[model samples]
Target chain A: MTNAAADTTPAIEAFNLTKVYGSGNTEVVAMKDVSLTVARGEVVALLGPSGAGKSTLLTAIGLINPPTAGRIVIGGQPVMEADHALVDLRAFRRQHLGFIFQKSNLIPFLSAVENVQVALEINDVLPRPARSRAMELLDYLGVADRANNLPDALSGGQQQRVAVARALANEPSLILADEPTAALDSERGRQVMELFRKVAHERGAAVMVVTHDHRSLDVFDRHFEMEDGRLKNGTERNIEQ
Target chain B: MNLATKDIRHNFGRFALTTVGIGLLLMIVMGMGGIYRGLIREATLLVEKIGADLWLVQGSTRGPFAEISRVPANLEDRARAVPGVAGARRFVSHTIQREHRGRPLRMVVQGLSWPEDRGAWIPLVAGRPLRQAHFETIADRSLGLPLGEKLKLGKDVYEVVGLTKGMVGSGGDGLCFFTVSDAVSIQFDVPGEGVRLERQARRARAEGQDIGRLQPLLLERAAGPASGIPALAPPQVSAVMVTLQPGADAAQVAATFATWPDIKVYSTQQQINLLLAGMVDKARRQLGLFRVLLIIISTIIMALIIYTLTLDKIHDIAMLKLMGARNGIIVGLILQQALLIGALGYGLAYWLGTFAFPKFPRLVVIETPDLLSLAAIVLGISVLSSLLGIWKAMSVEPNKVLS
Candidate 1:
């Protein structure tokens, strides 16, 4: 598929994705024939207990760990089929994908603006424009005032905001967030969840978040729960209150 | 903002400390090289400074430095008569230990055939060269002999007339110049008791033994020094130093002298090579070994430091890899850090060598080409040392960040 198809296609499509760890007697299936689709401007939540393969499915969709048997398309570009990368995954990921981890995972030495700018810089943006774009993203995320602060200097919520700004710096079509607000308090967590919702709605980017907290379910357009490495159908649960 | 510089700035104290440690090691390496150069300089200084085109010594021996060489003093005239030779002088060199104010001082006494020749070659720093032939001597300043001070050698006393700087033998001993007649007397003169014992022994051995014409010869040999026992055969010299006329080929003169059965002749260049390869070879090898060992130690230390630094940043490296940074970028970061450390260490070492080497007890000769070569070696070592860190960084799995 060409880039033109990306305009009208869903932001992510995974068909019968399978992931296996080890082999022979030690063989374990992490994900089994998982199929999922997320539309543009959609916010989705993945809920699961430990070892439920939520991380596995998340990593698989993030193009970090390719599935054993699967077909994945992101932004109308055929990215991976089975174990082979149909595209230059690293370059494709750099151009079309963004990630947010449980912790901010910011480069400790870089200031907030620099951390965000690094993402744009990796995408071949010049320093001046990348700096401006980083500042714009920081302002969009309400962390512009902390742009010069290093990650250590920022509060947990502020650091997460800066991380969000970093994820959006490249204008990626899809953002994969794995427990992005787990370390924050309930109010801070809700605020971060709402930020994800705003990002997906305002920027027309697909956002998938893996979280154990049910308090912010309403912030997502659809909810997913996993069990035994299998993804269940989405439930329209609105529990934002 | 270079990543390597940022990292170094982040841990400035530790980075500076490591650089200083490596700098000290490099300083020692450079000092060893300087000492080697100094040895070469001291070994060939007198040979070059003597201003002689060729050296004629006893056959079957390398002169002065390698073995004892003695030729008849009359050979000086024969060497001067050679086709290309402009002048020739009898040169006598011997080491002797003497007492000065209750302190023992070992000195190399050089005997010049013509006293006036001292002014032509020997560099006097404080006083005039030897003006009179009998008891006047020019001493190397390193001996601490004051001008006009009296020094006793054997039974004769001489006054120091001048002081020369850096006029040392191959063994680094200071040299004192005297007239050939005085040196020969001090070196070859036997004590009065030994002459009496030899005369008595000769009288006892000749009693009623030679019943023929040998009786006159035996009676004459029994005579003492006052009786002139063959006049002591004129005084032998260690070597004849020859100076060539303008445009004279030293090789041609040396070749002509080589045909003589009892004399070995060498050009000045050949003598320098002999000194360097023969006399200074062991010291040079020892210094070369030290330099090699220091280089190895430096390489190992740098490798360990870089490896430890890389290990400390494994988390950051994983994150970078996860963020789509290529292996080349990470490798470049480590290499840049290594090169920075090398440059800083070398700079510190160069500074230290410049200020510290002169204060050392021995001569340390630093040359520009040596420093340039050291820099190239340090760069090569930096690249080689960073390989360990580069390998570690490259092996870091991007998936490690997920954990």
Candidate 2:
């Protein structure tokens, strides 16, 4: 990750984000009047049950699905106001945001290293450096030996690690992951969760992970709980909700 | 970083088989064009090689090949006497089927004006032109005749004294060159029974009249054999081939012959046009229709294949968008594969055509300009075909990955 600047502004500040689907009688609120902030150099966990808007809020902050009503500021810049983009959303996403999904979601045709290198290439980085940076990320993630293998050839833990490497390829300020370790065993899941803590502390990237695994709650710097499309509680520093 | 090549490498076997299938289809399309071109070449081959500036045929007829035209052989002398005419030769052509080595053989027998034109202008692959002329023949290789092989045709046996290659008639039969007298004789030669019947009929007519009683010797001579009969004129030729001096105007000389009541005049190019317009026109349209249909089929197959490839990568495309890949990258991935298939298929077609075309009964003449045109056409098809896949890829929402 690029060095974090000495600014005190939070990495992400989302205000009264509301995402509604359909219209009139058929309207459904996926997220309603939700406000949250994730500071740089901190790892936060979003804990909720299914249909509690955890994923909806994650996608909203990731700039993939804009909230129907709200303001989103990332890295001290106003990015979206009520679904109207303040900047080119795709460029902004490439420069400042990263996402990890429930599945590894690596391009099946690309090798582990290429999966990471492609992310850099999408940001217009040259191949040689992209490859070099991909290698460093793979080495840091402890999957360097499996870098040349296709995603199908890697194990669940190894694939998730490669996905993490890819998400970190652009050195973004905010990293959002949705159930990234849901498919792993308890030991592997905790290990992946701890790796997020290391990344947040060492690289100074604000990390937000949506998960139902309360067993790894101690690894996060803070915890936010959601129910019925609203934040039920927000706790600081490894506190149980 | 090229997603197209990476995906192909991952599924090399399936991709290769698909390419081969498309390549074979493209080969047929390319071959159709070659066959049409070959037809044009075959239609104009004799006209171009005969080096005639003008042709004098029977009045109001399209002669020699396109339609039947028979003028007196004496037209050669009249054509030669025209102002600015450098030379004139008798042209006679007719198709005949005869038995050779117990197999039915078809050939277009063309007459060469003797002494003045001894088949010297014909392109020879082996042996010499008709030296003695009466029984010597110059045969095309397509006739399967070997040099020195003598075959009995009609009342005379003609020896294959020379060999030529790629000499085909407008009807797609092999061509054979013979002396004008021999050709005319072969055309009119009758069996012994036919001659006897013809002579008997003539004698019976004479006997029915009062002149038979006073002309018994005339009846006896006429009834003996047709060769002994003195009443018949010489056989007619199909046309008169004329060449002009270097500075002579062919249109002027043709106009002069056009004024003659007994003959029609045509330039060399006009004869070629008549053959193309009459003999080869329908076949050209048929082949052109088939080519267009095959191209359309190939385009549809390519579009479906690309769309399927994109469908297989739907999840990956969504993920790529989620990772901030631009629309250009996704579009490039599909477009590149389509273009690659077209380029590879075209290359395979050209390579296959080299050996396959020669084996066909009719010639397949593939020219350089046609190849270039086909390549451009294939490129256009590739681009058009890929739009389907590109549209599908572009519609994939990044949120789909999150879901």
Candidate 3:
């Protein structure tokens, strides 16, 4: 396990995570023996080159793509092993985890605040309370001024910030960020990276971000690298199968 | 629910287009229903107004309304004497065309037995009944007849003494009632001026002893005064109206008359089915075909709308899946929009169907059951049409986001 996650029990843990696409002779391993953990209140960086299977590992950890043969434990509960079984995938995702993507990916129809509120509402929060909570997040992201704006009206940085707020709306324990800064410039990208660090430290959430750019690595509590379907330099993060 | 509302708001133009398409189809469906009901409404007014218990016609034919059938005038006396009989009235029904204010009112003339006879069956709205033996009439308001209005028949002008309501024939022509003798005269009356002119023309030609003068003279000397009046009733008519005495068996009475030679007996139900219930049934069936066609067009239009709307958001759907939104959530959004359009279109259709067209010359009696059942059927089809979008949304893969 990585040192930070190993300091106490991890909020997220993977054991020998592997993903193979297609079957038999035509098969290609998108990820092989990926193992990492991020403890509560820690922010970790996953570094890789283009086509280095960063997305596959993130999808696996996000509980969307079940690993071909591996074990996943989230919040001290066994979730997927060999084949995926994560209680109800929809409920587990809605209640336990958050996700951010390279693009803002906010639903274009919803206003910035409503985009975040939808997450809380879907989890059955009362409307007034959900709206208040969404407003708090918009304020925290420094996008409260544009809270009423639709996605089409917001600047790129503002949209991505709203997406981050949406991911945090349900008070999820683990946040997975896949290339979350790829769409921003160095200054805005560093600001978004620092926000993840602040969220992890202040809210006690475990954050794992996959990125190709190394310019914002200072915001991460720890860093690991992946190459050729495996982690290369991070010995403490190597999975035991 | 939130996603559905959001999607519709974001694509307001698309949703409005869908509603317009559905509205056009709904308009056609409602129109067909109105046309079919109009025909039935008109054709039933006569029989419904008369309120008879049983109908008697020639043994081999159905008549007085549906066809031509005549029997002896003495048969009314015979029919009134049958056991369980209250009274019988002789009614002579035939069509007449006359000019009123330069427009044609094709009327069905009913020759009533007398005031104490079946005259009670017809309601007179104004003025007096036929006081004279002939040439006085009670006309339906559908003929646009006002009090004391005169209709030109050949060379004579007959004054409208009374007005009737809702009396019509199987052909949807309104009815005018007169004394049996009056009806006979109106049916047989030859204009005196025309006869005189013809006689003079024939004499001037001097071809022979003129045929017109010869026939009237020959017809008059050897016969009664009414005999020369071509308007008099024939020795017989088509049918008698039968009213039952208390606790009488209508079925048995009808059965008793069933075996009579050259005559047919019908209970009110048989008469309704053969004569009135099915007046425009074939036409209604055709209008029903048009309704089906309109609904089919609506189904196709709805399918295209939902499909296009789904395609517009292929990226959003993939992103939602990537964000761990359930397939159910995505599907609910599309289906809710479809049901919204259905509810709107049907609401407008029912409102217009019930209230808009009754004032037209043709009556549109939209039955309540038809309105309700059609609404439900249209909504069900709308939901089915919506499933195509839901299915397409469900199949999108989050892996596309990774790519």
Candidate 4:
């Protein structure tokens, strides 16, 4: 999927984003003046070495951590303009964005399908419709067979697939995944990447994932490499599938 | 956070176990509270149930009926003369051991005189009140008296015509209600054979006659209540039961007795205070201490439980924080869980406390206000204990999950 072929809007934008932890001599700059935009229906992979601020940038854009200085726009809406600083971030995140972590992180008590359904439930969705939506997401992710399996009972790759379905449950325009394939093997990692691409292209969700694994580079529509708190395009971005 | 339902379902075992622990602790708190109420009831049981408003007793006596009170029989008449005094009667209570069915039964013989028809105190719970008042007695049900049995007191036998309930004395003795005259006779009536045999033996020693022959003769000579008896008569009575006249206060009427100077006086309330309430004051205090300690132990245990359960969710909580969940949502989740647990514990406490005491060893009184207050107190404790962990969870950072 090409960014130009996608919807006429930016799915996620971060301008002049900076995250500084601590103060004075002990201050650590996690992200410094970082800016990026991913268009709707495009999947972008953030590539970086360890400690290159890949997670910091991802978290800032994900709204888990507000940037110390800068503005963030999600789904073409200026959600963080420094004016709504006191606004509720958790409710905003629940309504507008989704998250996937290295581990499946599905609540251990609920079944694979219920894990996705709960995300919608927390947003005050009616339980009946919530179940229907959860099942649809699970079916789309190609793991409808294991919907009843708990997190511990499912395979690692299957768990990650369910986690992806959970992220897609609310139909958010942007799905932020951090090291989404870190726990999967090369083959399973490719499958998960392809799923994210499908969600980006078919569901019109702009997907961004932080990955250390280079084996799955062919799956992303765009790629940027982060080094020492800054992002620059890699030769891999120009590489054809 | 999408975690409330998940956290609860995810650890069903831990949740059930925690609920059970809270339930047990709640039961203990309820039991202690019930026992305390029971103590209050035990302290006031006999007096409150005796069905009288004023007690006329000898002056300066205030317990073992309200304070230690013993008054002359004439005090009842004098009490009736006082203004606002409608009626007064005499009641003498004395403890005596008698043989019934080859078993020694210790009984308190209560002498009820005219105008003091306290026989109502012993309702025909088993039989009827003493109809004749001369040869019949009414007794508490616990006395183990049959419907028609003779109660042998000294030389004569008093028939049981009625039985009553809830008339326990301060010393836990069963009361036997008899007529005033009957009680007086029993107080002094000597065993017929024993008195005569002693006298005959003494005379034989002094008369130079054969001991067996003299004994028979003396026994024949002393035939009835009229023979060989000094007849000093039984002690009249120790106290009287007085009722205040309509519209007249018993305390004021009792104050009138101060001028009489012949005897001491006690109002009904004073008698209840001295005899029943005062008798059980020590027990009430002991039970009160027990209740306080149990509540402290339960609260501490409940607090530890809620805290431990909260700690078990540390990892999940950290993850929720990392996933863009707010502190308020986290706090609400923990608090909802805590309060629900508290509510369940309180429900169990109320049911067990209110229904469990009557069947207990001693009567336990569970008042409505006490129940309501305890519920509020337990709920407050639950909220307070949960706050400890809520604060800790609030201080938990999202960075903890990322690592």
Candidate 5:
């Protein structure tokens, strides 16, 4: 499902993004004049302390919470400009964006395979193909043997792997994660972070993960650090290993 | 897979138990409707089963079931003499309490005119109709009297020769078919001591008169047994059932009987209307009100259940919303569960009612139209009740999952 347009353009581009909450005396600026770009086939880490505007920036780029002032382009298409949507936000998210939360957030009632299949089904994909594609993604994540198990039955790492498979179900151009491996042990957390790297390079999709763990810094192709509602720096890494 | 069913499978125990609770409520609702239908059925049973075209009752009385009506037993003959009357039968009905097998049994005694009307019109579920005129009787099976059982009343013992199903009187009591003479004897039966006292009173009153001193034989006759009395009229009947000739206008025939000063007249439909309006009007209203209240309660319970189920899935719903799952998907989850609960409950109501209703003290008549109408109402309720859950699900903020 990779598009030719995605190959020729940056996967995500944010220009002068800002987000403010409340108004008057209660007004707080969560993110300020943040700008960044991530190319296809790249994995980037957003590093910050607690309340460092990392989530605000991610949500704005994901089109979940539109910024107070910004322009967002995904796969060479303008999606949102200063909270005014250029395209249907929900539809655009379903077709091109995917998210993974800290808790895995897999629907408890569905099996591991069904969790992935539902993501495709929401996009109106027929069930037969959706299931087949879901199975393939689970196999790629090495959790195919546990595909039929419910979320509660899976190990923390396995559950996060299933969540990753679900995020990759729509072949989205951009995948965002907020502490995707927070619940796992160090070994499992590193494995999950590495899985995002493999997914980004092999599927040619841009991946951004917000994580507090500094132990897996070498897994990313680039790093963006934030402080006091502003992007402090962006640095490229040489990760030949 | 359908998320609603999958979730139900995930929580099968709780969901099954909840469905059963709902099923019981539905059963009670259905039973309320059945009870009202039964009341209507009982009130008009004799009017329809006796196959009468017109009823000749006592003057200005509704009679037999709705009001007290006592006409001369010979009115059957008078009604037969009318031009349009093809047949007329003496009809007497009264409820009696008797002891049988050490249990106080209440039954409605219906007098069937022998020779002319031997209760051939009654539908017997077990055995033959009244074959003997004096003692053989047909009883409703609901009375718990088996075949060949003998019941005593008024110095006579009657044998139960036949059984009818669903036959009841206006008061929800089982009916027993007996000859008119037997029924009248039971109605007027007096203990031996009371009879003796009545005769002694008559003798004393006669002796007190100067005519008694002039004629001693008149005084002796006044003190004799009631059977030897020369001036007593025959027993009175509650009403006379008249059947008209083919193509006879019942209204015209009733108009002719209305002219007589000794009797009142009513067409069969009029008698039925009178029975419904007078005998069971309040009871029907009570059952109808109860049914409406039960339905409202069921709806409220369903709404609360669906709302709670949605609350339990709040986190999952937020996750779905963040995943870009549309509102339709979330709505489907709640709506489908509500409908499933309703359908399963409806099915269980019928399944349980099949055996349970027959055992009720009163008749429970479940009709097809009532079933269909209930199903429609349940469907509407399912949709309406699911709205609360849908509203809550829609208000779920996707950002909550991220936080």
Candidate 6:
């Protein structure tokens, strides 16, 4: 359902999403009737073991791999239903979604500032303003001093911080991250987790992170667990205020 | 920042090496084209310099360069008598090998009737024209003969009276100018021993025929000083060069000579075409085939370079896709890099050609139009070559970043 006002809209909503890997005797279901909803300003952790379909659910919601049967909405607009895309997925993704992967994956040829500015540029932002906004995001992410450095020149923690700056450069309403800190040390991972929390709380954006590290669970406002292509207990644990 | 430039800077050594490799190949392609142009220049050099409007040669031959064409020396006078004919000269040409400074030199000797005829003499680079009729010659500077030097040809020594530049025959041999009478003697005079033997045989035959009254008359006719052997007969000429009045139609005047029993007429343009299409046709075709093969090899090399570069950066491309970069952006990145490489290769080719062509054994004429067309072809090839990389980049699934 479409919300009447943007202020009251949920950041993400999905109903009965299912992803099947194959057909006939080799058929394997990766997501089973999964449903989820996250309000604006919410930070949620998707916790699961290997092969538990956390990545499948995350990729489906990220508009990368559409589910075989589902109704999905993002930022108050219906985006997909039953294997059909309701919008220009690439444009919509560019304008409304941000992704952070396990590796920084910064384009090696570009500096940190350029890496961040490119995201805005692809969204039709003028170069001058895009550059300023990139600097501002970098400043906010605590890696402003490293903006001119190449990815290889920066420390692991600094690279991830620059990646966060890039993800927020467009000020997207929703952010999806897959093991964003899997390569960082415990302290760097915790720092990256806290950065995501700050992004969600301060920017009023919804964040969904699929991660195996449980040490940073306290940073999430709500938590969900997945197992064997199913969400357990249909439960959502809200951190005590 | 431009993605193509940034990537190239990041991997400067590899990009430079690849560009240089392509540059060498492009240089070869352009060199082949230059050789073809050079052949055309050499083939038509004499025809252009002769300043003649028409050529009269033996009727059965194609022209002097394409085949043996010999017309009588008197044809020049007959050609001059034609109504629209402005002037005519007896032209004789033959290639001869002579020893010069211990090395054999092949020279194309051209005979001109008048020593003052500018149309017949090579463009003088040094010294004066042929001042003496029998033993003076103007030689092309390419022959390495200095002014006032004596050169022996067929038992006679001739002084080099003048020097000329760029005077070469269709076969790329340097040209030497001599008086028509001298050239005829040099080309056709029999040895003295052969002449003496002919005289003895005639006297023996006369003595063998013994009719009482007839014997005395025959002996007197054969032995008298008045009947002594005269000089060898005058030599024949190859062709006659004809000039036309300003208002005269060369084709029309040439047509008048068609009725002549043993001679054929040709316009200057026809002779040039004969030289090119008949004399240099095979060389042109072979050069064309080599150019085509080099182009094909350059394209394959470009495609492989771009494709391999793209493959090396699959992760980067996938990351760009994941970040919502449109397929167009990715395609542009690859295409721009390819074009840059093409430009670098073209620049290197032009530089190499400028310094290298002059040193080639044959003439190599590098013209502006050839370079412009080559640049266009290189650009087109770059675009075509980048297609494989574009396809590979576009097909990179954004979801691969997750895996």
lDDT of 5 by residue, A166-215 (tens): 99999888999998888999999999999988888888889999989988
Which lDDT tens digits does candidate 4 get at residues A1-241?
3343356889988888888889999999887888888888778999999989999988888776778888998777787763245446767777767788898777676799888887777677888999988898888788899999888999999899888888877777888899988888888988998888888888788889999888888888888888888878534352266
Q: For candidate 4, give the lDDT.
A: 0.73
Residue clash pairs of candidate 6 = none
Order the candidate numbers by DockQ, best to worst. 2, 5, 6, 1, 3, 4
What docking grade does candidate 6 earn? Answer: medium
Candidate 6 C-alpha lDDT tens digits along B218-325:
655554332353432345788898999989977789889888879988888999988888859999999999998999899999999999999988888988887788
Q: lDDT tens string, model 4, B69-133?
A: 55556666777777867776676767788777888898778777843573765556677766675
How do the candidates rank by TM-score, highest first? 2, 5, 6, 1, 3, 4
Q: What DockQ, between 0 and 1, does each candidate earn?
A: 0.46, 0.77, 0.41, 0.28, 0.73, 0.61
lDDT of 4 at A27: 95
- Relative to the real complex, the DockQ score for model 5 comes to 0.73
By DockQ thresholds, what CAPRI class is model 5?
A: medium
Quote each prediction's TM-score: 0.90, 0.96, 0.84, 0.79, 0.96, 0.91
Q: Rank the candidates by lDDT, best first.
A: 2, 5, 1, 6, 3, 4
The candidate, 3 or 5, that scores higher on TM-score is 5
Error at B70, model 1, angstroms = 1.4
lDDT of each: 0.86, 0.91, 0.78, 0.73, 0.90, 0.85
Residue-wise C-alpha lDDT for candidate 2, range B141-253, written one tens digit per residue: 99999999997889999999999999998877899999999998889989989988998998998788888768989789768866677676578899999999999987888
Considering only N, C-alpha and C atoms within 3 Å, which residue pairs clash in candidate 1?
Answer: none
lDDT of 6 at A211: 93
Q: Which stretches of model 6 miss by more than 4 angstroms?
A: A1-6, A233-241, B116-121, B181-233
Q: Which residue segments of model 2 deviate by more than 4 Å?
A: A239-241, B210-214
Model 6 Cα shift for residue B257 (angstroms): 1.6
The residue-by-residue lDDT of candidate 3 on A8-30, one tens digit each, is 66888889999899999999998
- lDDT (tens digit, per residue) of candidate 1 on A57-154: 88888888889999999977788999899987777777888889988888876889988987887777888999999999899889999999888899
- Which scores better on DockQ, 3 or 4? 3
Residue B342 in model 3: shift from native, Å? 2.3
Q: Return the TM-score for candidate 4, rounded to 2 decimals.
A: 0.79
The pairs that clash in candidate 5 are none
